[model samples]
Target chain A: MKTDEKTRAPVARIPDADVPGTVERMRKGERRAIASVITELERLSAAAPALLRSLQPHLGHALVVGFTGPPGAGKSTLVNAIIAQLRQQGRTVGVIAVDPSSPVSGGAILGDRIRMTAALDDDGVFVRSLASRGYLGGLSPAAVRIIDALDGAGYDVVLLETVGTGQNEIDVAEVADIRVVIAAPGLGDDIQAMKSGLLEIADVIVVNKADRPGAEQTLQQLVGALSIRATMSDKVPVLKTSAINGEGVPKLIETLDQLGGKVRAEDAVSRRRRRARYLIARAASDIVANRIKAGSKGGLDTLADSVLSGTMSPHAAATRLLED
Target chain B: MKTDEKTRAPVARIPDADVPGTVERMRKGERRAIASVITELERLSAAAPALLRSLQPHLGHALVVGFTGPPGAGKSTLVNAIIAQLRQQGRTVGVIAVDPSSPVSGGAILGDRIRMTAALDDDGVFVRSLASRGYLGGLSPAAVRIIDALDGAGYDVVLLETVGTGQNEIDVAEVADIRVVIAAPGLGDDIQAMKSGLLEIADVIVVNKADRPGAEQTLQQLVGALSIRATMSDKVPVLKTSAINGEGVPKLIETLDQLGGKVRAEDAVSRRRRRARYLIARAASDIVANRIKAGSKGGLDTLADSVLSGTMSPHAAATRLLED
Candidate 1:
């Protein structure tokens, strides 16, 4: 009878067969249960579906805030400082640091996580570093699932932090309710880099390390650049922070709180719907990839022939398939 | 007649209308023509398709070699040294440095490219820095198209250099005929990092910075790790190179040449077909994104609803979408 576990559907598996019991324990702030659920979901064990289903109703409780910036933007320092501010407010926090590095720096990423989160001894603060192993490398589906897991476990806030400003890193912004794009002075072309990609996604922009020499110029450039763009009618607060000194953090927290109630106040159903949309989009991409792998997709062979023969561009053929 | 330019399709646009002439010049080793054609294609200007079509018959001339590793692995120094050795053989080389950094350091990527390729003043050497502005942090469709441009322009070899080993960065492996994953001593956990991800895609692995202490140990670990991996049927040659001292590079080049002819020997048709498959797969991802944006893709809403309601896991819902 125990061997029957192998033949059963993934939703009916053992670790997750105790889904309800785990969920109950996790909600009561049992740290082990919370960690177990996240680990099983991240590894995509067979029990993930049942665990996810059980955790669904508890989703959307935590306000997911994302922090991102260029490599030298002092994001980890800012994140640690923000964690301190959050802890001071007596809010339980779960920090998920998602860095999809080249496969060569696994130890370096762990080293980074520990260094950033080392001092917090409070049980209310749980830190998990997610190495983005997704196809594109920013926030993976596992991170998405883990966010829900943290939310279900009753964390008051979930901070999603991603390293770098690559295309995939920008994607981390999509999942957060409040997206904060960080910048620092004297790191040349980062502001230009922001102008091209990160500026648009930012709900709140921070010029960290404001004590640096060119901080004022950097702030003005950002403000000027934001003014020229008419996309977001609401003013995106551009603030300066000296993360080392803890200066400007309290103001930052105040601004975040002001933005929070309005952003996170959407009804539970709508909030869940927004997440559903992002999830479905990710799923659709995976479906296309699998179909491509199978290689017998309807007209893909013919379309590839057309591309090689110069009758159609690769993109135009893909569009034709979608239309069909 | 000038007014008509506004309404015409991209294929028939001005810069691209001279596609045939441009291709003729580029094929004849005209550096300006090569640069111009590549510029137009990279920007995806109105004339890209026509330009691409014109270059079709001329593709697959150069052997594309990809160099990737973790940050501080000396990828730039190694690539530059290889370029010098390739130049010693009187072969023309085109080096494309693709770094999809977190958006903050536009200036830094440029600086690295200059430092890597600065000493080479030969007309036979063409070096371009491509900041990966792709959706993910690694290789993009633009990189694929530009590779064809370089190949058609008749560079004897194309060296593709991507910074770091993000998920997207490993993607540089896909387009290259020969994939070289580099490692170095003194990089903590980099060897461990390779075992998990970089090892699988590596055609020829190198323990770069071989002059450093622990070089032998890193090399042993790489060999041991490769032995354990069963996916790669052919023995992947592991070499050691000191980019600073120029030691072991000649053997490295010899190994690459031995692997190159066999890998690149496939007829132009199959070569084009391989490239087409990659392009089509990327297009499929884009198509899915557009469908998600349009929000009317058949039954996506229903799938999202099911996902939101916890009746189906996000991935299961995606699988169902593909089945439908």
Candidate 2:
């Protein structure tokens, strides 16, 4: 137990690992080895290629399912049920719940702690909650890499529970094979699920807390909204589940199972390919930003000050920095 | 009128001001001459040294205020009021709204439309909606440049309205001078505001829809949450407002006025400098990533395919790319 705790702690280290050394360790077929490797990677203050090389093989195997919606929508409850059903089928599972981070201290309580409390002791269930390190989408550049870790660790199905669907949760749209948006009644916006871009991204919509009033109304509204915006290319399914009583969970799993079968049969890999390219581009961009910020000897700062003061224009400042 | 429409159309004839020759024209300070020049700058997929140079004088004169919270918090309404008040005070305003892009088309509908709806028809109110070009925060690299355009255009206040307080919305926290999170009654999860990092980033909290039930409770909770989590740096103020009725709006504006005064007094220039550094570094990274992606033929795609096929590891693939 002590050794396991020690091993697990290093997975969250930061500012370490350029893409290279990590790749080298991963190439050695050392699964648990990457744990300590991420520790060293954290020390580097940037992603190394060697590490990325090591991570590539592990990422492609698992079916990554992203679960997101507004808070109190019982997202974890639904996820818990889905995991249990998959476990019954003898499938290994990996769970990544993106927890909120305290901006001041950079500490997070990992909300899934209470939700997945029962699964803690199960060796078949490996759940990790990533704290949002002030990155957009509740995901830092580290998330894709962490997903790689879970995939390499041999989890057959990876369940990614996002922070929510309000604004930034859309980051999951970049990485998931399937995205399930959970919602309930009285979310204030009668058009809660429909308004904004939320209407467009959901592959599967689950109206949890079905026992409550307005569940049917919520479903009808979503169906109505989907009819208006949805392309015939895909017919989104809306399901209702009472996460508290575990009602309708089996059907939700069945819906997911059917979708999974279809995605694998069709050109889902191509879609994933496009998304992967975007992710790589984003990661590379993050690295460049960090490098530029670190390398500038107060040059960027001074220019920023000048621009803000109206003494220099933003474009002039940007041009100078880029050209330099 | 028809000719003007033809010119303003984003897809129509490229704005001559943004053309290659625009830079040469700009060095001469030909005011209306540069309008076409600025528009032409948007078409080029390369670095625009001329546009950057032209914007050198006005990058940071504006006080950037980000208005965010849950949907229906009357953010637009509040902004409209502020615009009116600022114009009364004889200050020009620039608005950037980060709206979610269409999932299918990735286009934004509210870009020019929302500003018009707000009755901000004055020559001084420059309003633009920035849709995501597949970026995480629904903001493009062009956004900062647009801010520059507005700044150089002589706007004293730049107001940025993000999609809302989800993960992506939080990214705005890093880019603005003042972040005002708008909340209202019946949100239910006070803890969510904290969990989402809204409470931490807010320099001011406006509980819009003050007439709604639970408004007082929500405000109280927000106050309590801030007091507990805040460092010794500053205390965030929570104000009540009805953007519809115009109640508390004057107070809100006064608060903004006071905050701006304080920022100007205490190292205002230095603060802009820090933000400028952050922006440049971020942009520099985007450039590097774009080059690497474009430079590598289908190299990245092939490796991603292998990883997906379970043939090679992610780390291995990333390693190969790094070596290249």
Best prediction by lDDT: 1
TM-score of chain B of 1: 0.84
Task: Compose the digit string of candidate 1's lDDT tens values, residues B1-324.
Answer: 222255343333336457789899888888788888777666655566677788877777788899866555677788889888988999888888775543435536456556657564577788877776532433665677788788888888899987643434656777788989888887553234334356656889999999999999989877765666556635799999999888989999999999988977798656656666777776777677566757664477677766644456677876776566
Best by DockQ: 1
Per-residue accuracy of model 2 over B204-251 as CA lDDT, tens digit each: 899888988988887776665566664722567789998878788889
lDDT of 1 by residue, A237-281 (tens): 999999999988999989888888997778755665666667667
lDDT of 2 at B183: 75
TM values, all candidates: 0.77, 0.62
lDDT of 2 at A71: 57
